[model samples]
Target: MTEVRKGRTAKRAASRAVKRRALAIAADGALILYFLFALFPVVWMVILSLKPANELFSTYFSFTPTLDSYRTVLGAGEDEGVPFVRFFVNSLVVSLGAVGLSLVIGLPAAYAAARWRFRGSENLMFTLLSFRFAPELTVIIPLFVLYQQLGLFDTYVGMIWVLQLVTLPLIVWIMRSYFADLSPELEQAALLDGYTRKQAFFRVALPLVKPGIAAVSLLAFIFAWNNFVFPLILTSSEAQTVTVGALSFLGGDRPKYNLTAAAALVSVIPPLLLALTIQRYLVRGLSFGAVKS
Candidate 1:
């Protein structure tokens, strides 16, 4: 009777193990399907960009691939009419400029808001946060007229200044949280060691939050880089970024889908490369102060 019971138990355990393996395989397959579904549009864009102009509308996967679209966008090939290089460079300058200005202005502001307790300080911080939730369209018309009257139309200064609306609040709010998460005891210890308040901030607090700065700066840059409304309305030619410049490929009598696809894919490279390069800092920054232990 004992021998028979042991044999039955072993057989049941083997059957249960096989079922668990099958379930694991099914779950993995489902996750893979979801990933592919999410990635399909990007994959399609790459494929379309690689296809020659003649094969752009081809239904099947047998189309010939060429570098003509990329060449044209980069100003090295047959199509020289559109200066994509200028547009791309403009984006880099404008995005970096906006983020730089935001850091300069927002960092001190965030630290103050974090450390001080002035009357109406909460109201002031809330007011700054409110700017982000307000839609850009509501104020663009007034801003448009204002920029025109002030001689700031279609200029780098105008675009970078205006993007402060997008980047500033984000930096201030996130950095405020980072500063708050830090224990005041650290700065106090520095103070006891003969460091002035300013010195404490620069030598102690600032160094500690470097990862957070890296993470938030990248976020701000991505937002500023992808901004459409400000650049679309404010810039006509000289300072137009890739967000608007990509549309130029479709401007003529007939839209060139291949060129448009090529422009977009090329435009994605810089931001993608930046995110990949600083991914470690970004991860650390994001996870900063998430757990006490």
Candidate 2:
């Protein structure tokens, strides 16, 4: 009887283990399918970019690949295209600039929001987040008129300033949460050691959240970099970023899908490289910020 009881228990445990493994396998299979579905368009675009213009529409997978589209966009081919390098630079500058400005302003604001609460504090934070919820188009027309009036149209400074809408709220809210998660006792201890509040923040509390800052900054930069409607209506040639510049290949004489694909792929390089380089810091930041102290 004892031996039979032990055998039954072992069989039940083995059956449960099999079910768990089966469930895990099913979940992984679903995730893989989703990844492939999401990646299909990107792969197709890359293939289109590599194919010769004449071969672009001929077949999906059976075409002679060429570098002519890349060469054209980069100004190495006989057929000239937009100066994509300039657009790439403009994107880098505007995205980085907006994120920098947001950090300078939003960091302190986030700290204040995290550390203290005054009247209308919740309302004010709500107002900041509201910027994220509102459609850019709702304000773009008025902004266009205002930009023209203020001589901000098609200017780097203007582009960076406009992107505050994208970066500022994100930085403030995320950093606010991170700062809140950190224990106030750490900063208080520094204050007792004769450090000023500012010094305590700069020397003690700030260093602890480095991971969160790096992750959020990278995210904000990507958002600013990928913004399309802003560049489309706000900038022309002089200050346009890659988001708009890549589309230029699709215009005039005849549509150039191959070159458009190449330009699109080229534009992805900056964000992808940046994300890869900072991936470790981003992961660290996320992990560190998640735990409440």
Instruction: Provide the TM-score for each candidate, comma-separated.
Output: 0.92, 0.89
Q: In order, what is each prediction's RMSD in angstroms?
A: 2.5, 3.0
Residues 236-269 of candidate 2: C-alpha lDDT, one tens digit per residue: 8899999998888788987889988998998888
Clashes of each: 0, 1
Clashing pairs in 2: 211-285
Global lDDT of each model? Answer: 0.88, 0.89
Candidate 2's C-alpha runs over 4 A off are 1-29, 77-79, 290-293
List of clashing residue pairs for candidate 1:
none
What shift in Å separates residue 5 of candidate 1 from its native position after superposition? Answer: 4.2
> What's the lDDT for residue 214 in model 1?
89
| lDDT (Cα, tens digit) per residue for candidate 1, span 1-293 | 99999999999999999999999999999999999999999888888788887776655477878888888888752264677889999999999999999999998888888899888988888888888889999989999999999999999999999999999999998888888888999999999999999999989988999889988999999999999999999988899999999888887876787788899999898889989999988999998944110
Highest-TM-score candidate: 1
